[model samples]
Target: MLTDVRKTDRLNLMDQRGLRTSTWNVLTPNAPASKNLLSEELRKNKVSITGLTETRLTGCGEERIGNSDSLLWSGGSTRRNGVDLALNSLARKALLLHEAVSDRLMKARFGHKHGKMTVIVCYAPTSNSGDVTKEDFYSALSRCLATVLPP
Candidate 1:
């Protein structure tokens, strides 16, 4: 298993123990089988939290996986760029707030021993994307970061 999983480029903070997080750009997990496989992987790896990109899940909602793990997802009308967060039992208890900022971005706040930490998961437009699209994503991300609570 990889050591650390924080999207540091988006936001950097001190690390905490026992919170094994990771990020994956899953093409899509709309199918039940795919979701099941994903869940199985989570357990097998013992991931405390995972950031999912390109989920393509319409709308925003939470899903309970088995009796402990949970999935928080966000997306748009069409089956396109989406992101989500999968929290195991340990991370679930630390979860305080979450939001579906847009199809390309999602945010979650966890209450850790050091107070709180905000995690932003995003799927940025590729270099081939239009300048406007790239600008929009960065702007939205900036706004999201601006709203973080003071330490």
Candidate 2:
């Protein structure tokens, strides 16, 4: 079983191997304090790229979190179903494209010397949501993926 300690160790191993990526469901990232806390956690974990779900942030844009971290988020006016991608300095420097597909989905592309990496952050509808809503969310996600052609 992968306990918390094992998870941390595994992540550290991945970092040592130069594979620094992570994901989190932050639930709400609209506040500066929350963003700061998340940034600190990412730095502590030595994660270069992170996908965040349910950010609850409105509008769509790119914002610098700290001196070396950046966030790309997408959300609607209702303060719900937002997604984001956070990138450390190294990943930010390699950032080639970012798209706010919808309140439920966001995409980011980073160009490395070896090739390109595409990351998608998504929030699917909860079970409480209606069937139509769930279907729409999946359909939107599909469209977003379809549009992101390979480099």
Residue-wise C-alpha lDDT for candidate 2, range 43-100, written one tens digit per residue: 9998888988888888887788876798888889888878888888777767766778
The estimated TM-scores of all candidates read 0.85, 0.84
The reply for model 1, stretches above 4 Å from the true place, is 1-17
TM-score (C-alpha) between model 1 and the true structure: 0.85
Clashing residue pairs for model 1: none
Report the C-alpha lDDT of model 1 over 114-144, residue by residue, as the tens digit.
6678788999999999999999999999988
